[model samples]
Target chain A: MRSEIIITLVGMGIVTYLTRVLFIVGMKGDRLPPFVVRWLSYVPVAVLTAIICPMIAAPEKHLNLTYDNPYLVAGILTTIIAVATKNLVITVIGGMGVILLLKFLVG
Target chain B: MSGPTFDRRQIWKGFAESVPVMVSVFAFGLVYGVLAVQSGLTVLEAFLSCVIVLAGMSQFASLPLFAAGISPLTIIGTTFIINMRHLIMGASIAGKFTERGLFGKAAASYFLIDESFAMATAYAEKKKGGSVRDYMIGSGIAVFAAWNIGTILGALFGNFLGDPKEFGLDFAAAAAFIGLLVPQIRGKGDILVLLIAAALSVGAYLTFEGSWYILITGITASLAGALVTRDEK
Candidate 1:
């Protein structure tokens, strides 16, 4: 019970409810324009990429072209699995393996 | 009589799909609860975190932002950036709801998790006219239940987790993220966008100063990929 924490949670809950409920209550059977819809379709991938990519390879405070990068190894493995089999479980296993390998081998 | 709008069958379906994932996500909630509580969040706050956001990645991302003393404005902005993916998910689900009334379409939008979307789309592809409504409730039940249960467990028993370091629950966010992502890449649009976004987001993190950079790079890259295809098809 911190008052601030409770307040924050309430704020978070209201915002979340609005975001979710707005979609259900507002859109119903309606639609956005084709141009907007087309743009919207790409938003997920774009935002996700912007969010996660480089952090994998260059986690240091600064970027480098050096050889030691755990994310690069993980990325390569993840990509190969994704492309070859399109199997998520395999790719995750691959990433985990890379994570463990990096912990043991690189450090 | 026709089934009620929120029928028991659909609720049960939702419950079933959600419980298994709850097991996995529970570990994560434990991690979150311990950290958030230690950071001075109340149990109610921790519980509400899951109910409100209902997203692992965003909530995890938000934690460091809070700890770092980032402004609410910055936190909101970053979250909006991270979550812009839902806009695309919403758009993809848009046409699927064409047959639904405005209210029905609106309701469908709230339950747009990866599993729900995949299963519902599969159901739609298999059957004409589609079970968009049914699938939404069915899959949504699982996602919703899993999230709530995981959060509550984390709040109640988070201390018993002993050390998150030993169990590697920290990886839960990345692991769960990739797990959900891997299972969902079914088409060219999805693949291309995912690949580029992955690359660019990593790149941005390497070069830029903040987590927001990752979101920026990812959004730009995905938008580029999505533009490669035409809507007419």
Candidate 2:
């Protein structure tokens, strides 16, 4: 493995452990401010949308909004499945199936 | 003061309740492992990531950035933000551990994943006197074992599978993100945040040159959404 990769993994591990351990050990009885909790609740949806939007909209690092973009079509379908089913396993597996079928027919 | 005794019944109950969740976690881990190897991580690196990081979403989010050759610091920073929710989860679970000693609390904290936290919370609500800590540890161990095993097997399979794009695995990350995000959208505020983040992130990807878009959009959109919906309740 590359040295940089190792450093990144270890850094990630330390920060992750800190996030989990801090409140349990140091701030046993304290509660996070309600606003902070609310803000934090929004983090996952925002960050996840940020990540997913580009991958689907610009899979080639440039805009491609047509059916030729398998990621886009498959992503939309995946989102529907996810929202409707609310099951991770089904969404992922179903998404992959859509992509494969698209690639087979279009690509 | 002595720590609470390790209740085998509570542990067993926790482990049993986690079986359904374990299946999904294993599936997620399998995808992560495959994507990790496909994104240029060696098998050892992929396996180590599961063992060390243990946070599947952050680990999955890092793959594309890592594959793009983004700096280590940026990837690590992204990991921190992605896992920040754990702080809230830990705080909520801490109430159950007031009787636990420092060592016991610290040790139990290591096993605190999303599934374990939810399982412990539900167990506490359902049962009157059973040990939540023991339940958490049991569920944690079950999740940990499934995740690591799935990762190893998937990593090996990915190593042999050659190109991920052939199998349409390239879209797995986006698919996984959607699966994670959609379930969390409970109100108009969340939808607003999602739209804003999506627009800003795509714009940033086109305008900027690096992965800073994620961090910038995450912080800006969430804060804006929270403030805008502050009076909704």
Candidate 3:
């Protein structure tokens, strides 16, 4: 297990470093291709949504769309606050508060 | 020295802009630390993962896979795909580092996590009178420090404190991502892309394991956005 851990860490480090430095090393002073730039502009939203949605929809490792699901309830409440306020602290705090409160009342 | 150098004032401003992001990163990191240890990793292993990989979501996504005794190569592949977005992120900001040359860029890019990249790129776009590299470094350093500190604390004391999920600490990552994502939606195309991304993500999740869905759905959804917006211009 220790050996496996070392191997995984080393491999992950190399791969992550390569990605982080890919453009930095190769691009020099040139502008990125316009098409690439347009596509890249959407990457963040795509990736972030991809990360968030499944977790909310399946907090238990499977789909749970029921109204009683605390995560789903808090997730909707959080999404509304997130879009409305655009403040990180409020969204996180407000969302967590809702989740815990719902868990207390519902669970 | 001709252009804006790494002055104290600029560094201070950069640090100030980063405090909020750093707070969220710290929260996420603390949760990851606790969970990693609970997932059968040693404290030292968890700490090393933080210092080495430094990517939050991938780290969290891989913990369960690792504990399941999956192949190391497969885990590495999963991590790489989940982080491939960084290639685009690095490329987007590569122009700002032209003056710094290769070594300086190599140093700065090491700390180019999502928050630092967003903060730095937004600052650069404003054409502000400060060194973009310096601002990035400041924000990056704060995030790195907070992550490492949070990891250490959680790894050592997490088991004693009980499960992080009991208080909805499990929602930290999702909440942070939503907080980050909401600000990026600018137009109908972005909204369309986001919905497509969410749908594809959940669909892919049903068919896939780990974080492959994030990579596959994210890139595909971005392509959908590109196609949708192509006729606009």
Q: For each candidate, what's the DockQ? A: 0.34, 0.74, 0.53
Docking class of 3: medium
Q: Residues A4-95, candidate 1, lDDT per residue (tens digit)? A: 54455455544544544454445545666665555555665565444344445555555543557666566555666656655434555565
If both were scored by TM-score, which would come out higher, candidate 2 or candidate 3? Answer: 2
**For model 2 chain B, the run of ten residues with the poorest summed lDDT:** B97-106
**Which candidate number has the best TM-score?**
2
Error of 2 at B36 (Å): 1.4
Please, what is the TM-score per model? 0.66, 0.92, 0.75
Assess each prediction's global lDDT (C-alpha) against the native. Answer: 0.57, 0.87, 0.78
Output the better candidate (1/3) by DockQ. Answer: 3
Off by over 4 Å in 2: B1-9, B231-233
| Poorly placed runs, candidate 3 (over 4 Å) | A58-64, A84-96, B1-28, B31-42, B60-75, B98-101, B118-135, B154-157, B169-176, B208-211, B230-233
Query: Chain A TM-score of model 2 versus the true structure?
Result: 0.86
Docking quality level of the chain pair in candidate 2? medium
Q: Which ten contiguous residues of candidate 1 chain B have the minimum total lDDT?
A: B164-173
Native contacts present in candidate 3, fraction: 0.72
Ranking by TM-score: 2, 3, 1
